[model samples]
Every structure is written in structure tokens, then in C-alpha cells.
Target: MAKLYVIGIGPGRRENMTLRAINALIKSEVIVGYTPYIEYLEELVEGKEIISTGMKGEIERCKLAIESVREGKNTSIVSTGDAGLYGMAGPILELAKDIEVEIVPGVTAAFSAAGELGSPIMHDFCSISLSDLLTPWSLIEKRIENAAAADFVITIYNPRSKGRKKHIEKAVEIMLKYKSPSTPVGIVKNSGRDGQEQIITTLGNIDYKKIDMLCVLIIGNSMTYIENDHMITPRGYDL
Candidate 1:
């Protein structure tokens, strides 16, 4: 039976990827993904049929992967974070026909960024992407407002891009209506990959200029705090 593996590469680092992800890649006769994510596979995808596309080519990649699988080639389509979370898994499953599809989970940016910035996600949390390309900005704003009102620690993805610079600021504005100005916010760039950088700042003090699309921001809830430069959201454990 032809099979398609929807795999998550995990923060663009080989070590961060799950062993199953690696094995899936090895078993695949063809590799498909966004261009940058394909590079992260490095030598693992060597000698395989590589189908890569630039940003916003997600549907194309999914179609190509399905085509490859239908042609009797075991194919692996990769996404940076857990494929299920704002990754390739959703579309692949939605567009796929009868081909066998397996979703291989990997460490998402939130968890990777959280590990680098202490434990800001130790409590209840929700992730929201600031990119309004496919989603409407009004919807994004409403989600941000609800997450803030619910006091859920928020992990923001696609916080900033060349054209979407003001979205993060708008999100912060919505959050400010409910969260305190002193709420801990951890920003991590490049996450578990090379050139990783992280900083624990406050909701009132985010240097928006320092953020980019590669960055993930974890905004702490009311119970969250910064101690010893690490963002910590207590899980209610007794001392």
C-alpha cells in the first residue's frame, strides 16, 4: 500500500526531531516540504526525490506529496513543528484520498520556546498565530481577547513578518486590556535550532523590533512570574 508520512521536524534541529520522524524520512522514497524545512533535513533526505516549495506553497506541497504517494512512492511531507499544530498535517489529511497517512508529531515551537525560556507553559495555555494571511485579523483579535480574558498563558506564533509588523502590537494591545503590564512574556528566536536567542520580558516592555517570523512569544498568565531571568508559571505545587 502506498503511504504518506506527515512528519514534524521540530524547531529545525535534527536532534529535536523525534526518532520516528527520522525513521519515516528514511523509509520515504521522496521528501516534500517548504524549502527551508527541507534544508533542515540535511543529509537525511540525501539521494531521495525532494519536492520543495517556498512560503505560501503549502497546498502545492500537499498535492505533490499525494501525487507521489499515489504513484507508489512512500513519501514524507515535513513541517517544522508538530504537524498537527498549524502545520502540514491538517491539509494533507483533508486533501488526501485513499493513501495511507500517518501523522508524526514533533516538538512544537511553543514547547521548544518554553524549554528555552524556563517553564511559562506549565499551566493552562493556548496558541494563536498572528499571521492574518488565511485568517482574518478580526478573528485573530477576538481569539487574543478571549485567551487574555480566560487568563490562559498564550503562545503566539508568526508574531511578526516583513509585511505583518503591526499585528503583534495589536495583539499586545488586546492582551493589555485583561493582562497586567507586568505579565511575564518570553520571546525565543530560532527556538531549538542554531543561533537560538531568548529573552524574558514583561507585557509592557516587549521590544517589538527585535521580533521576527522565526520567533515565538509565550505570554504568561497572572500567576506567571520572572525569577532569576526565567519565566515561570507555577502549577500550584506546594513548596
Candidate 2:
């Protein structure tokens, strides 16, 4: 039976990609993914049949992969970061009812960003995407509020886009009510890739201009602090 592999490419860098992911891609006959992700894997996928589409074409991309698999072609779909974390894993799994599916995990942007900063996610943490395209803003806000109330280290994805600008600002406002104004915040752009940039700021004074859709925003809990310009969240260790 033909198999479908949903692989995470991990920040679009060869070194960041897992051995399993690379092997799956090597074995697959067809590779399908978003254009940018496909372009990132050009070196590895040189001889394979590559199918790509633009943004917001997720369903189309998944359908193509499913069709390819049904035709007895080994297929792999690439996604940036962990496939399960706001990547193509969910859609592919949902669309793949009878096909044998293998999900290859990789480093997510949250962890990549955390590594660039310090250990801001050392304690209890939860990830939330600020994108309101599929999820309603009211529900997103509620989750953010509840997470803040629970003091979970928050890693926010898709914080800002060209069309949506005020969402991040509003999210910060909601967090400020539960967290301190001086709460440690780390912003990492293009993590694990060339020209990567990171900065440590405060919740009350975040440089909004520095953030984009490609960036990950880690808002630390009350227990989080900065030591020697590095963000750190204690895990209740005796030190």
C-alpha cells in the first residue's frame, strides 16, 4: 500500500530537519507543500516531482497529496516547524481517511525561538496562534486571558500579518491585565534560518514593528525573568 508522510522541515534549514524527515522525503516520489516550503527543500527534492501552491491553498495541497498516494505513489507533504503545530498535519490527517499516514515531527518555532532567547518555557507553557482566519477573535482572546490567568508561558504564532495588524496589540492588552507590565518577552524572527533575528523586550514596551507573520512571540509568565540579557523562566528548582 502506498504511504503518505506529513513531514515538518523545521524552519526551512537542512541542519534543522530531522533524519527521519529527510529519509521520508528521499523515499517519496512526489513532494507537495506550500510554495515557500517547497522552495526551501529544493536541494533535497531536486529529482522528485514537486507540487506547490500559494498561501491559503492548504486544502488543495492536501487533496493533491491524497490523490498522488491513491495512485500508488509515495508522497510527502512538507510544512515549516512541527507538522502538528499549526502546520499541515491536521488537514492532511483529516483528509486522509483510509490512507496509511505517518507524521514526522520536527522542531517547532516556539522551541527554536526559546533556544535563541533563554529557557523561557522551562515551566508550564501553552502555545496560541494570534491568527483569526479560522478561529474567532473572541475565542482567541478568551484563551489568551485564561492562559495568562493560569500563568502559562505563552508562545504566540502568526502574531501579525499584512491584513491583520491590531490583533497582537489587543492580545498584549489582554495579557497586561493578568501579567506585569515588565513581564519578559522574547521576539524571534526567521528562527533557525539565515538572517535570523531575536530581541528581548517587556510586555508593556514590545516593539511591534519588529514583529511579522514569520516571527514567534514568547510572552513569559510572572516567574520569568531576565538574567544577563537572557530570558529565563524558573521551574521551581532549588538554586
Candidate lDDT scores, in order, read 0.94, 0.93
What TM-score quantifies how close candidate 1 is to the native fold?
Answer: 0.98
Which pairs, if any, clash in model 2? none
lDDT of 1 by residue, 1-239 (tens): 87999998899988999999999999999999989889998999999999999989999999999999999999999999899999989999899968899999999999999998898999889899998988999999999999999999999999999999999999999999999999999999999998999888999999999999989999999999889888899999998
Model 1: colliding residue pairs: none
For candidate 1, give the lDDT of residue 175.
99
TM-score of candidate 2 versus the correct structure, residues matched by position: 0.98
Residue 142 error, candidate 1, Å:
0.9
RMSD versus native structure for model 2: 0.9
Question: Candidate 1, 128: how far from true, in Å?
Answer: 0.5
C-alpha RMSD of each candidate structure in angstroms: 0.8, 0.9
User: On a 0 to 100 scale, what is the lDDT of residue 36 in model 1?
Assistant: 85
* lDDT at residue 201 of model 1 (Cα atoms): 92
> C-alpha displacement of 233 in model 2, angstroms?
0.7
